[model samples]
Target chain A: MITLYDFELSGNCYKPRLLMSILGLTYETVPVDFYPGREHKSEAFLKLNPFGELPVLVDDGLVLRDSQAILIYLASKYDKTGQWYPLSDPAVLAEIAIWHDFANRITATASAARLGLSMFYDVDIEAAQAGAHQLFRLLDEHLWFGEREGRDWLCAPSHPTTADIACFPYVALSEEAGVPRQDYPAIRRWLDRVKRIPGFTVMSGVFPAGPAIEA
Target chain B: MNRPNPYLNDHWHVVAGNEAVASGQPFRTVLFDVPIIIQRLADGLRVTAALAPEKPLPVLERYGFIWTSLGTPMPLFEIPEYDEADRRNMNAGSLGVAVSAPRAIENFLDMGHFPYVHTDILGAEPHTEVKEYDVEVSAERGEVLATRCRFFQPRAATSSAGGQEVEYVYRVPHPYCSVLYKSCPSDENRRDVIAIFCQPVGEERIVAHMLQSLIDDVSTITDMRRFQQTIFGQDKPILENQYPKKLPLDPRAETPIRADKSAIAYRRWLSQMGVNYGVIPLVPRVADV
Candidate 1:
């Protein structure tokens, strides 16, 4: 059985879990608590991943970290559905790469802003808010042009690929970081569509029961 | 300078405005067949499309489109009020039909499942409290109309320090489109709103129009624009994959766990909006309320 080292609430850790579930692969979830003494940095965990990020997937003795890399690996290794990862054309790979950059650069930044402001440490609120806005606007422009032209999936013609999986969590979770969903209805609608996918699972996060008051 | 088609295909058509779009005026495309009309409206940019009278439109087909304002691609659709018969036949293959209103509202109420479903990107935990709500709805011509509704949720860390809030808003224009606004506010009161307009094209798909702007003067718009571009680049893949041909919702398929609050609420909201709500089973465990 594959062993997934993860934190229950971490989005980065949840990626592999979501992928495994969607692909119907069985794995063991080893929970790591980040709040107490930095468990990820322990020597034993370091042997698995020097980076010490949660969500280290160990399958058949092959270890991998980084959510996107793990997702790519799992799909390439075990996915019976070729729609998840395609090695057919150069353009497809290029398209996947474009979204991979999106996940790493854009999504990471947004996630960081949320973490800085809400979870990790209280950083410069102004700077973090600015960063979040900047990211939202850029995404808005891209979607505007993309929708006008007809193509639905980011890279492929019809079906979703690994690229979509890479970007889904953070963008949807931006709202949790205090990024308003009302401002980006297109994105919200897109989120709704993603939720409709079969075998789709949500990331583990806290959501306010009532409407949140703006501070 | 030549700009590659954002949709990645050459055969799709693009709509710019009510007037025929010029061959090259920076318009968004949808489903490789229709073009969305983008224009500056009194509220913001209005995106719509004109369809030929003779065109064969589907019943409830939803399409994937992008809103430029946020640098994210979003799904857009046209859903008529549900008929009882239509509600019974809800399935993945028949998404074009309308569904229930109560179910849609229920979907909107659950917000706890963000982390598990999208994972790594959207959720970090399950079950957070909502701090405030702003809602506006009206009845039009004997039909229950949703003029606008905004919901806000605060993060835990900022909860004590007058935490930041995420806001969601929705608007509708009869036979034209629906506009949704999502915004974020920081502890320092810096705010940005991303506006998306969903316009119908044929029966299945709608074109998404977008605009994003920051309320803070601390940063230059150019800087904001660059930042928005990077963020949208990340969201492109998921949004692109979600539309045109979306996977059908199967309520009877699996029971969601306590972590799936958001997904559940979202489904209820869709039902309340008179759209079909899939019949996914609710997990037996109670969410951390």
Candidate 2:
């Protein structure tokens, strides 16, 4: 059995939960009061992850930190198809690495704006919003071209990799940060596709996408 | 002692989908520029203007939508096809448009922009020509009907395997409602029904609720909604930047062609009904100095 040190509202915590739900893995959630209590920064939680970031995942005895890294670990170990992580091909791994880093940028900007607005964290709202827009423009164009090329994910894979999972939360939650996605049509479409994935779940502000047209 | 309230007209507008507002949950939105609240009561969903929070408007749960009218309204229009046992009734999500309610309705009535605005999905560049179609205003029915319309689409729906010829029937049963019956992707003999119910939030803003009654067993509800959302998302940016945010009632305000007959008839019907709720009158040209 796997255990997740979780925060209900945090998008970072949601990434692992979302993937776990998708992979059909059973896990126990130890809810950490991330908002008013700030339990993640407490002494006990810091011992689990010295970086003091959520969410920490423990399976058997191996403890893991960072959302993207946890996603890598989970998919690599659990995914029977070997598709979600796709570590076999060096080229695909490299591509996934690029997007993994990009997800960090999304956390820095979009997540920062959300933290400032909802959680009362002090942040430069203007700069964060601008940075998010700049990143979203690129992602939209990338997905637009990807649609034309018959690719559905961030990397050049037929199936979704960790890259798509890594970057999805902040982009989907950008509106909470005062960033409107009205201009990003392709990104909006991609977000719907992501939400339509089976076993998909919703967070506090993230709503589920409606059904697609029949195949 | 008081002037007439023009916005409080007798028009049944869709406010939300049945799935959007659950029982014991309250949903708030603006309709006809009035802030309103919707709550699912034991009997049905109750809607009322925000000013008078206690009073409830007439509610009708039809076509997978929750509809309410501030004034006395005629019976809701009928779509006989929805009663079919084999069809899947789907409530596509609401889409917010920066343009006026009528402009969004007019856009839905139009086929000319499919080639450009929707691009390869609805229409391609080479198949830009919209063949002449018959359009008429039904005085007895108080509606506008456009028939015998056809177009070639690269991908008609999420179920579409490739390009095919799509037959279409457009109807404007209400000033804010535009319904379309088109070729079904799952079964060639059946017609898929899609309708857009425009909620006029302001003179230049609307929340469009879409419903699709389709004949498909394979596609998930999420896929169906996402497909429609994708098409609307493609149309949003163009709709927002249109000049004269509210649609002009006068025909000469915007040039029309043979393909715009449905749009023409719709405007004429709105004009005859004296529906100035969400329309902008044509501005008179001033003589140059």
Candidate 3:
């Protein structure tokens, strides 16, 4: 069975869990505790992924670190025709890539910065809030346009690709990280659409109970 | 003692009292940091601040005065644009305007439609009278309790035409939330009031924030919640698809029957409040279906 090292509360960790469920793949969750700072920074875990993230996926001895990359890998390995990954069209892939970048560069970073300020460090909260707001506004604008234009999924038309899986968890959990979920109604609608998909499993924070355990 | 004008510092307003001004009189008393007049006539309630020189005499005479005038006459136009803080607070969200309607409280009491439009989704049966109403009120909020009669109806069962008595408890969270309580006569009411928060986003557009809780006692709450979700899902697409301009009503375009009483009443009420009422464009005869 595919092994997913995850923290339930972490949106990044939820990415793989959601994808695994959607893909109907059975995977064993190896729970990691971030409170005591135990497994993340361990030397053996670092050898698997130097970044010390909890969502490191180990399948057939192949290690995947970044959440987006792990999602792409999972889709390619399990799904046929890359419905989630969509390898047929370069333009489609490019669109998906933009959202993937947004998840990593903008949403992930801003969410982490804001979460760090609130949860871990005593950094300038105003600055962190500002960063979070800025990111939310950007996502809101995109979602607003997407909803108005009658687009079915983010990053593509009608069908949800890896791009949606890549970004949905963070955008959904951004509220817990102090990223004002209510401010973005269109994004909320988009999250609902994502939830209605067949074989859908909500990210840990989206619902109180799910397969994943809270980090 | 002279009370400081709360409206001067904040943008929020509250209802102070509901009193009968004259025998056979029907007026809603609203305290907006200042006394205001709300007279309910055959058409609807006409709200005016107590500052206008044109007394209620003309309005009373013109409408063939019958009811009692409750508080002193107030000017409808003299009520200044709310203070900046209230303006900011009110405009903080896109759906704020819907919540700002004076009749929102009354509208929440309506539970007749639970089984019709949202029947399969909410599991409400028609023609059923509410058996019990439990109300809980506090300084911050209030709740109303409603219970439905028990039956072993499952999703697979065909819908019976007969009605079931349902119970409802409405809760208000002071300025923001109005949570519905969960109680079940059979098990327990586990349903939550579907609260709608309106935030003003633009001159004409308001975002509508809605939340409903899952309750255990009422199996119907689950179905009703699903139905509400479906209705909202449909409404969002249509509302979002419409032009951002406030829609006007076209009386000749579509004939409204008794089933549309609530929506029609709400529209008339809004019009009386000086809210711009939009009319849905007339569909072609061929598009009637």
Docking model 1 quality class = incorrect
Cα lDDT for residue B223, model 3? 37
Candidates sorted by DockQ, descending order?
A: 3, 2, 1
Off by over 4 Å in 3: A106-110, A208-215, B1-289
Which segments of candidate 2 are over 4 A away from where they belong? A1-215, B1-8, B283-289
Per-residue C-alpha lDDT of model 3 across residues B1-289, encoded as one tens digit per residue: 2221232113222221122233345343223233455565566434455675245422332111111223333322111222222211111111112122222332343444334323443344544333333333332212222233222211311122333333444433322223333332233323323444432222333333444433333333223333333344323322333343444343453455533343344344333333331223333466676
TM-score of each: 0.42, 0.62, 0.42
lDDT per residue for candidate 2 within A1-215, as digits (tens), equals 89999866678988999999999999997777554345688999899988888999999999999999999999999999899998788999999999999999999999998777544466998899999999999999999999999998899879888898899998987876778899999999999999998888766557677799997
Q: What interface root-mean-square deviation (Å) does model 3 yield?
A: 13.9
Estimate, for each residue in B173-262, the C-alpha lDDT of model 2 and write its tens digit: 888888899998888888989999888777877778888898888886656765676577556656766888877887888898888888
Candidate 1 lDDT over residue span A1-215, tens digit each: 89988765466776777778788888896666443225688898888789988778888889888888898899888988666777666788788888878777644566666555323333564565567677667666665566677645566457777777777777776644546556765565455555655677654342212332455
DockQ of 1: 0.02
